[model samples]
Target chain A: MGQRPGDLSAPARLAGPDEGIGADELALATRNHGLPLEALRHDVTPPGLHYVLTHYDIPYVPDAGAWRLTVDGHVRTPLDLSLADLLSFPQVTTRVTLECAGNGRALLTPRPVSQPWLVEAVGTADWTGVPLRRLLAEAGADPAAVDVVFTGADHGVERGVEQDYQRALPLSVATGDDPQVLVATAMNGAPLPPQHGRPLRLIVPGWYGMAQVKWLRSVTVGDVPFTGFQQSVAYRIRRTPDEEGEPVTRIAPRALLVPPGFPDFMSRTRVVRPGPVRLSGRAWSGQAPVSSVEVSTDGGAHWEPAVLDPVVDGHRWAWRAWHHTWTATPGEHAVGTRASDADGHVQPLDQHWNRGGLANNAVCFVRVVCVADACWP
Target chain B: MGQRPGDLSAPARLAGPDEGIGADELALATRNHGLPLEALRHDVTPPGLHYVLTHYDIPYVPDAGAWRLTVDGHVRTPLDLSLADLLSFPQVTTRVTLECAGNGRALLTPRPVSQPWLVEAVGTADWTGVPLRRLLAEAGADPAAVDVVFTGADHGVERGVEQDYQRALPLSVATGDDPQVLVATAMNGAPLPPQHGRPLRLIVPGWYGMAQVKWLRSVTVGDVPFTGFQQSVAYRIRRTPDEEGEPVTRIAPRALLVPPGFPDFMSRTRVVRPGPVRLSGRAWSGQAPVSSVEVSTDGGAHWEPAVLDPVVDGHRWAWRAWHHTWTATPGEHAVGTRASDADGHVQPLDQHWNRGGLANNAVCFVRVVCVADACWP
Candidate 1:
């Protein structure tokens, strides 16, 4: 996880059985607005269990004490600053979702051939960091430095390819003040856990987890593009059928892109343990925020609007949890849900096929299993 | 790893050394070429320390249990054969390189963000698999089936949007008897490495790694484009800068776009041990076989044809190993190398920048380090 600055592993864990106390690990604590993993029942993904994507293995990075962000690639005034130097500037926090580009690649058309991933491929957290613009101004970055190179403490060789843990972003995005963009050192209001990037990380709200690099390191202002494999190669989208089969290079605006609704825990089988079963799940968009999440008790005929939480940070990629309630039932029935963003985007009727399994925002039908008695397999 | 068959978290290991010392591994050994390393090396990459990218974690997957090659989807007679079923048919071999679509992305312009890989991504290897033609004929694939979807054994989630681990080649490529399209179970004549995908992988020479789906599960026949995430969203090439200030989308044929020549040991500092230092490395083409190789000691000013071994396959992505003998030097000098294919295709000065870093076959360079009898630090 020492590859990028804000890599995603898990953040919290119980120190003693008493740690991670009630509500402390709750999703609301972060305002990510997602459903509880009622199946797992416990709040918050424990550190070890949190999803992780580390470009390089654990890197022994320069201490925050000596850490400096250098801006000189194609910049006017080359600037270098220590952690304290970085912190000397203003700071802000934003709640956002960091999902790996490869998170759902397994379901791709050619089955994106990369690392395997599981359900625990994403998480949300509050990030605090200096605005990239602030650093750019200080460095007097040249517009010619169209790209910014980000280096890390991890290094390795892959496929006869000598690689340094690094990647580059367009100066446009790097210079913007996305509240979701953070030079974060904490998670859930605590210093980052080792697995979650102990010292610092770059929390890129809507982009895939790969962009939100883990481990605090150096940021270089460059003229040409940074040629890190992660930047130039992996985590891209291939839209056409051609000889070289070029890739979708830049990050697409974040959008849920599918099944236009928050998931609902309809018709609970928790007959005895429940007064009235409450249904809940998270809905979000990368391209646009949610317009209104719709739920259907009978497949696609009848529809109802689920309660919406206040959207914050203008983060479209961060999902909002929507909840519904249903009385206990005696048998199996079909229940489906869909979500749409502010742009009137609706979930698809079926799957759209592509090479890699990316942008899979599709309508999901969660079959409700209610019983006269609590009987779950 | 199980959820995504090709994920890195699998338990696939190098089976007790010789567990993989079969025909495929033997092929590599017989040539006395290449150094296989378990991990990366520092500075000058030891032949043994080069990285290897495999489709599957386990190697040498036979059709023994459930390794069935299916041509379902929209085909006439969906072919579902076992490993042996595939091998029994006339087998063929090709010398080609399997490169990640993200290979030369590091050289892109906008500097789309992702992995931090230095050069050394592309590698060539010998591969033997079933001709897609043979299986297509046997499956009685309908002429109407415009595209053939190649699937893998890995389990994955599917968005109603798209949930398929498959790639589709026009019926022409899929049905071509060209020996290059293979259901390869071995690499370099040995059981394929797990990471490289064992139990039979697809070797579609002349394209990026995306075309070669490792741990092949099933091959389906479809009349439509495979709309999986990998196909649609991943691997897309961003053309020129757009009005949206984002990368555009398109696809090109994928290949190991490398500059001409075998690797020239960039030894800036000479080795004290004057023993013959063998110059060796692998080479392959995305669309064709490498016809010849050359090396330069004085920066491409003078050139000499280097020794190239007999490559294994034709018009395949499987790569070949080339080596040469060089005398030790104790002075500072520059070295460069280049390679060309049968079709006269040579490496480019640089790849055209697209949003996604996909196929980039630029020539490779090594700055030899030869000191006055100084030990490599």
Candidate 2:
């Protein structure tokens, strides 16, 4: 409320490093949402159940069929493609997992003051789209292009920088076949929902959600590394605001429990009857396929290996299911899970803090109580 | 971190009346979302854009095909129907606007420490299912039945009481022909999304969301009113902790603006250029159809009527679109909107206080700036 309209370059209000979440952060949290742990029980997150984080308003695309995508910049032949034109191309559907780079930001001490995600910012979806390489090949990208900048229709100001939502991928990643990048037009066999970027969006497999630009409108074959605000200013893992830190990409290995039993309405703390309870959850990694998962019934003091579901044929980029059977006693306990990928990147037992709190894939912990049978409904 | 699991009756941590939102409240906000103001532009909110608030975890129905709805208790003929059986009945679709009883709870002074909703907890959807009266008629309700209790598969503890999520409607309301209630199986044009009660749910038009139980499992006809925890403890308009107050029901007449321009990332404040701007939004009421919507650009000092879209042949329960054109000069302004219903219910200029913060339909206010053209994006 104290902001001056003329102060165009001023940073808006944020929660103090040591203070509780401010109204502004709560406002953002209410607008965007994190996946509920219970929803992890589903193999493919259903519509509306998937976690959503939009930096700007979901732009109103009055007529999606009329929307066009332009491929220009360093391309040898600039091309304009309509929805029907893109749909005519050979379509491929891939099951991929997407996670917010700031999944555990709020859990960090001196928490980064945006979104406030807490380990629930991940979901798997079957995205159907035309391969980006096919589009780039048709447009004849210039050999010297270094990055493919994707621009979305959503526009807003972030960190005092006003611009359209844009993100860029290295040219090699965009054209590679290992994990195909796609210009997605459908999700889960249905036309894209408005919030998930209806009309068109980019789906960068194995990368953090920032690489998947929604409401995509323009794709530029750039000769230089794209240095937009989102590309450089935000989504960076830094120790301080002044230094330009590493750009955040790829989902870090993480496992989350499905939160066994029912949750208290206000606290969301789990209450289960003392018995042999099956603990299950999903684990995924963008850097590499998840190789193993470990479970701890008594916090991080001791750990045991959990059974990992065999990798499916075509879902190498989707999450792997894992489970552990625990004979719970009647008492309070902290349950935790950690996932490690084939690349040997293990979740840290404790959090490593960064200025932006990007990619804090620490061990996921859930506080629960195993109540006596008589007390449970 | 301070709670004792064994002390079942103790209230969980709550933010003091004057304190900022606690982490627990923020956690709730991230799990549930309010409809973004821009979404009002859609006549029928797309999948995932609709507001959702699940009291407990979204119950996992392993096989929705095998799920059954039982009508028992005082009914003349207890009936158990499968998903297929319910689908064979005559289906009716209704476009209804459902609002949480606690829509503007967060705006109240000494705010209620619950979901912390601020105006966005409302959405309009086309719900398709069989009418509840048809089912009741088939089951042959007892003549002396006074209430119809709905029980959902979701079970959880609240205020130390454990039970399945349940709510009841007076028999008259459930059987009345006006604004027929439906046992909805599809939302929009697709099967119910998980977060929106997959398999089946009850949709009572013109009532608050609590009466429309999701993940529905049973209906009980009773000679006495149902006294479940959700009915007696929560969702009440209590003046003091000990007072019963009135039972919360029906959406209050309210109007919200589709925030005109781009928003700042952290604060979500709007900024616009110095020129003519068209403003549009939606208004609705539960007690009666929305009759008028008024707009105020000078912080409620003066008001002007907005043009309301003509009512369609159907969709009597859906929201009415309203718009106003304003000539802007460079300065800060607080824009407000207020709606009145045909029943003579007008939204208050200031919020009314209550213990549970239920049914607070105060005027909606949005802060914005008509910045000089030079500073605009």
Candidate 3:
């Protein structure tokens, strides 16, 4: 097989800011203050290290003492709900992974003209909030409403357009029976941080981060598809200005290798004896449960099925851990991992080229060296 | 000196796009429709090979027969001038090099989110047009005007902001005595191509390409600086979301090596005998003329002065050629080059990190192998 665009023979490093994820309580990744890949090693990412991708620089922190979320526009009964009112409704909690649409964008060829993300821009979090369907029902959303637009308080001019960060979902998805679609107020059993979303946020499970409007202020029911900047222009894949490609939506099937974090050069510290070396990582998909994961130790020439952890109910968006034990040799080697979902949506060896570089889920690899005389850890 | 972020020991190639510069009559460079670094080999770059960068996918092609440039807002005489009217006015021509602010961005560490550009996103061309100062003068621009906002016909939404491709210049720079600041209608003695701004374009000498509003439709004089999305937010370099860094404007001092383009593996077609090899390239700066250029054949450890070419009058933005001769060694070696401008602005061995990855002018190097028995070219 031909080498992928970003699969360099030597380890590749990006230039500019340092993106080291230190042992700090709150480790901040480099671009847009995102989470580091280290955070994904945990079955449930720590709240502090959960990737936070905000559109605006200053995330809006509503004064809980006076903040209100107004539900109107194409509603039979307009409603204004405060924090207390939102909390009064029955709450739903779910563990879901939110990946940036631009994840792995840096790996794209010809390169898109936006955030150049590697594969680290994703995190899974346990969110507690009221089901969005309940709020829409309480507000008596009009049957004719075709879409529900979620508007955030974060407003800024991007390109040349002045806009409040907004995105719309088809009414079917907005008012679906899926209890995972939430108007979230708390995360990891704590109130949302100002950087995440203070008073309220929209968490659309299985969708990319853009669909989960942070710092959410209002939910409006509209009779037509929202033609907001974020919906119609910014997020859609376009080969040219005139050609409108599909709008980015769900997360693609992906598997991430977590062991052997250090490269081969750091063999003095990371190398193991010529014995069995255990490898583990996580696999996920938006369309279905992770059905299987495969590991390759000879640069993908041979593959072996990995043992997957049992799936838990009610966490459809949660990733599944997979493990493999490899008998090591006393030399350098490349290891790779790939996953397939229950729907048979398998991770591609390489990502399909897109103008916006969205939805990249190419297989990931790590290089490791084994020391002949070293003892097992 | 330590290796810079992108100065890999081996010659590195950009991922995704095939940025090949064909050897046709025009020799158009691939990837963003830009000019290849090889085009800079000639003191006066061939018109056909000149680079073109367009924001929108479809370049706006105005009907020359009906196109009108409107000059209004804070102007004493609001005028709608046709192509003929623009042609009737006295014209000015100047050779200027235009570079994208994101040039060399791919080389930045941590990688800023935007076009992952290498160093090739720049070009020089002789532009013919009416001096913008003259046009503003004819319109009787108000003396109190603080900025001149140039608006292009191209419109699109970027990052959720809907904007006509627009940029603003401080009044002084917009109406300066510099004849290079033009309302360009022709490039390299030919009518501008649609992709190069067919009807009219603003040519702000020394500024990055963003300041050159292409497909010009209207010029608005304003009492306050234009706080357009591209100006106040998107282009600024920020360390954090809240701390606004300075807006990027002028091009930084930079020098690029031209010859020895292919790396060692391709030496069969490009290698020369183990003797003195002549090397040449171009240098330019927004603040001042390039004062000196240094070349290093053994990584960046040793450096020697290169012969600087004489500067031509009126082509202030044009890069000057620098030449060096290196005795060949029959082995692989890394060659590097850097430049210093007259204003004491020296090219840094490494780039200062910026969030937008703007204005990267780090020292660049190329890897080549000398053939032992080949005769000198």
Measured by DockQ, the strongest candidate is 2
Candidate 3 lDDT (Cα, 0 to 1)? 0.69
| lDDT for each residue of candidate 3 in B1-377, tens digit (9 for 90 to 100) | 22121221112122223222111100111113334444566665544344444444324243676888999999999989998999999998888888888777656666553444557677788888999888899999998899999899765434434457788988898899752579999987878765567778888888888888888999999999888978887678776666767989888898887646231110111233467888888888887878999999887888899999888784677888889988876666677788898889988887887777788788877655565432221
How high is the lDDT of residue A182 in model 3? 96
DockQ of all candidate complexes: 0.01, 0.55, 0.01
Question: Tens digits of per-residue lDDT for model 1 on B253-305?
Answer: 22221221112111111122243555655555555567777766555677677
Reported per model, the fraction of native interface contacts reproduced equals 0.00, 0.58, 0.00
lDDT of 2 by residue, A46-84 (tens): 888888889989999878889999999887789899999
Candidate 1's error at B27, in angstroms? 38
Tens digits of per-residue lDDT, candidate 3, A18-132, equal: 2221111011112133343434556666543455555543342436647789999998898898899999999988888888887876556655534445576777888899999
Which candidate ranks first by TM-score, i.e. highest?
2
Judged by lDDT against the true structure, how good is candidate 2?
0.87
> For each candidate, what is the lDDT?
0.48, 0.87, 0.69
TM per candidate? 0.42, 0.97, 0.48
lDDT string, candidate 2, B1-377, tens digits:
22334354346333565587776777788898999889999999888889999988998887889999998888778989999999999999999999988888777787778888988999999999999989988899987799999999988878778789999998888888777999999999788988888989999988898988999999899999877888888888777788877888788898989998888777788877778889899999888999999999998999999999987666788998999998877877889899999999999998887888888888977878777755544
